[model samples]
Target chain A: MFSQRLSMALPYAILFAIAAWFFYLAGQFRFTPRGDNIGPDFWPRLALGAMMAICLVQGVRLVLTGRDDEPGLTEGFAAEDGAAPRSSLLLAAGVTLTLAYGALVTVLGFLIATFAFMVLFSYAGHLRAHRTIWLSSALGAGLIVILFQKVVYVSLPRGIPPFSHLTDLFLGLF
Target chain B: MDTLLQLGHGLLVCLQPFNLSMLMIGIALGMLVGVLPGLTLVMGVILVLPFTYQMDVASGIILLTAMYVAGTYGGAFTAILFGIPGEPIDVPLLWDGYKMARAGQPAEALGWTLIAAGGGGIISAIIMVALTEPLAEVALKFSSPEYFAVILFGLASVVALAQSSLANALISLCLGLVIATVGTDTTYGTSRFTFGLPILEDGIEFLVVMVGAYGVGEVLARLERGYAGAPVTQTATARTELPSWRQFAAIKWTFIRSTLLGNIIGIIPGAGATVASFVSYGVEGQVGRRKAQLGTGIPEGIVAPQSAATASVGGAMIPLFAIGIPGSGATAVILGAFMLKGIQPGPQVLLHSGELIYAIFASVFLGIFIMCVLGYFAIRPLVRILDFPEAVVSSFVMVFCFIGAFSIRSSVVDLWLMIAFGLVGYLFDRLRFPIAPLVLGVILGPLAEESFLNTMISFGNDWTVFFTRPISGTLMALTCLALVLPLLGALRHWLWPHDFEETPHSQGSP
Candidate 1:
């Protein structure tokens, strides 16, 4: 019960912190002294102030109710028995994979990085059929490359040195 | 008579081999997404958008309109066969659809959905064709103040109908507006929050945020739950058998009532098909002749929700074409498509591109017919689509997310921002914050700011122009009412906590 209440309070606290930071940022927003104008900072300031008030109301309600307002949220994230640890690991891996793919594309180019990511992701997802995994990844990556880079003419990244050669070879076929 | 001639011309355009093929592909994709749980109609539309960059404006709009029309009808597949609703808009289907399917009437249940969606969608499309022009003619007179006021009304409606707490919704909206203000100020040309990064000067892309939040963020959240759900067993065959004319005549009133109710709700910005379906279900229960038998696998329960859900598609297009405002998240993406195609969808578009607008209307009718036909004969294959595990589906979605993010400006920075927002979206989902308002805010924020700023400048910084102009004044009043009604409800809840039924504060339903 206490943990649920804390979980509810945590969001409000984070919102409050953001509100405070925006308030500080609002101080740096300079206004021009021409023609009685409200200036560029006006909308941001008003939005921030409104956000601060909303956060305060939410904080007060969380304090008074001592209950999470949305049960679906709690139910969705509170984790079922024995499901927490495994899911948590999966979530971490997913985030890491996503970030790694993003960074790798700049160095390894789009096709190679995407193919590698798909294979690893399929394996991690427990698709133990090796032939299926390899075929699907290759087909998916090849289609994406041909469609986006060649047909649509989107200027996808070509990596340095060795990866650049591979990217050129792939694009040459299309 | 001129409208008729123009519509005939539009029909000719729609029948072109290329456009017809695109429409079919769009409907098939829409049904695929709608039958699968966790793949929303909005996400389906967004993923398809990057593919449309190479197509002409008319074909692109047709493809999108086809998807939007078919998407609302496709969710009944999973909602009937399995207990799980494929989309939030299909929740009302679960009341009697799953029950009827389990009672060995799956074919009949599927037929009711087909009839309701088909009949209601066609009627709504006719109404859309008749109504959009007169509305745009009226909107032609609107100035900056009226535009600002209407945008405020749209934002207010979203917050008021939001499933999350009013405060949380407002906070999410304000955050979106702030993010929108990150780049150089449109009015003064001064950078606000770039923090020395050159890329920030161009501002964050709404598409990047949207693809991240709905696609990648959804996948992450599903992973957090260990991607656990019952594997669906497909029992339904290919054929759909509708009720007899006499049996359909018995529920004629329910069909008419729900269709009208849905059209009205769809015209209201922010309350999309999900809310329409839910409201129609509630109203049907309260007023229908078979109220007592609503949850007992009856035809009335299936008819009301499905008709209302489908009718809402036509209703949503009204605001988009008439006044340059999106009625729902899916339409917001359509609005983005319009902007990308360099066609501002407002009164001027009606004047300049009437043929294109008529073509979209024609596509809607074609899409409705094709969707009904496909839903009838393609049930078995669509049901088989659910056999793929959530893990594989989410992984593919992640790849799409990566491509979508990178395709916008081909910037690695955009990809990073997409990942960051994905994490933020996951947090918001876990905490039960509504993401819809955030999306609306991002899409509509700049327009609101530009309008408000322009109005102020035109009126010599007089803020009261928003309340002084006749149309603007009435809209401002409505905006206030929209904001205040929720606060009053909250106050009442606070004062007498036990007065209301203690239902779960569910996310993603009205």
Candidate 2:
């Protein structure tokens, strides 16, 4: 019961704070309504008010009635019936790679960047064999570039760092 | 004849060497994604959406729809071999199919399941093609008021049928509604929660929310469980490689019956494939199996649920084409793609672009036919992988969950948002909250709100319009009935005697 109190109520309070902060920020919107009745602020304010009211009610309800999900304190995190850490780490790594790849796509160039990304993921991340990673990555990059550039005519950047001669070559020829 | 001619054009587009290859690749990718635990059809679609941006309209859509069909079929592989279902829709299938596998007829179960699924898909696809035109005509009559009623009906059905406590499901819905309000107020064109983060201008993308809720949340839940893979058993039996015609014949009626049931149920928004699959499976069990024979591995039992589950693809598309309103989570993503393509998928499109609609209809049939042919040959090898240790697969699922969340809109903000929802999802899971209602709430919340506001503006804020409009009025009454009838039933059962409630399994008693 005590842990449940900390787990649920803490988030509720923090979320309320965040909501109020957002409401204040919404007030900064440039107000313009040439003819419409409700100004730009109208909906934002309404949302803020409704959110505050609901959150207030939720907080009050939790205080009045404790959560029924009382965990057995004796159950350690590992021994608890559920939980896998490797998946979380891998997922975190995947998110990092996606962001990095997106950020670096222009700089690294599409072909070079995407090839590196795939190779890294297949090898270091997924633990695929080196040869398999190289082959798959090369194939994946080649296919994507061919489809986007030659067929659909969607232009990806020849890329920023110009590390990829292949992308430059493709973009030049196509 | 005109529609058929349009499809001829679509075929020309689809039959392009690159487009055909992409479709095949997408189907394979869909199967791999679906085979993984924790990753859903929606995840597969979200992850692949970015790749399709470079494609033309027809090819892009062909790839996505192919993924949808293939993903649904892919889940049965996991369900049949291992007791663990890859998707919630396959849960009932796991109960019987796994039992059959355990009984040393893994091949038989796999073979029969493929037949049932293919059979159901083909039947429902035909029905969808036949019904799309008439259904579109009906959809043309709907206005904001009618949409408002339909949305309410949809929401209420979710609450009525969701797992866990009704209060919990309602709470999740409320939470979703709250989240849906976070972005700019579309009506007023003002930021609601930007907090100086430019990303908040769009609020949060629904794809991000879905990926976070299902993907990140699944990882968190798996981590909490300390789960490793289940032990692999011997590879499938010879019975699977050569399923007898008689076995196929025996389950043929059940396959058709479940397909019909799935199609009918899927037309109702909020009542998605999971419900259709489970209900069909249970109904078949009650009718076809003796009480004593229920738990044992019966080939017919596997057929009934698997067929019905896949049939939902055709059935679910009915409302999508008819009214432009999506019927389930995956369909919601399809709707999003339509919006991205500048195509509003409602009656106007049906009237003006009937050719395109028919092309899509034709593609659904052809897509299933292709998936069946491909899956039949691949299932033998795919089924053997059921014996792969769960830990590796589980970890892989976790990784995809994270990546899937991040890929939506390619924003780091969504990653944070996803983690936040993952925590929320975990809390909900612990407290017996129904995830589906929350998901449905998020999917349809904006539409519900917009329609309500629009109807108010049109009628001078008169609530009476909801009751006065012809289509809307009936729909409103039905929404009320959907909510009230279930409560009344529970009340009657409570006030009187009910042996069903006495059972321990009725812990999820609504």
The prediction achieving the highest TM-score against the true structure is 1
Q: How well does candidate 2 reproduce the true complex, by DockQ?
A: 0.13
Tens-digit lDDT track of model 1 for B144-177? 9999999999999988887767777888899888
Q: State TM-scores per candidate.
A: 0.95, 0.78
Query: Which residue pairs come into collision in candidate 1?
Result: none
**Regions of candidate 1 where Cα sits further than 4 Å from its true position:** A1-7, A29-32, A68-86, A126-129, B235-238, B501-510
Report, for every candidate in turn, its global Cα lDDT versus the true structure: 0.83, 0.66
Range of the 10 consecutive residues with the lowest summed lDDT in candidate 2 chain A: A69-78
Regions more than 4 Å wrong, model 2: A1-174, B1-19, B159-187, B197-199, B216-227, B231-246, B289-291, B381-446, B481-510
Judged by lDDT, which candidate is best? 1
Which one is best on DockQ? 1
lDDT of 1 at B338: 89
Residue-pair clashes per prediction, in order, are: 0, 17
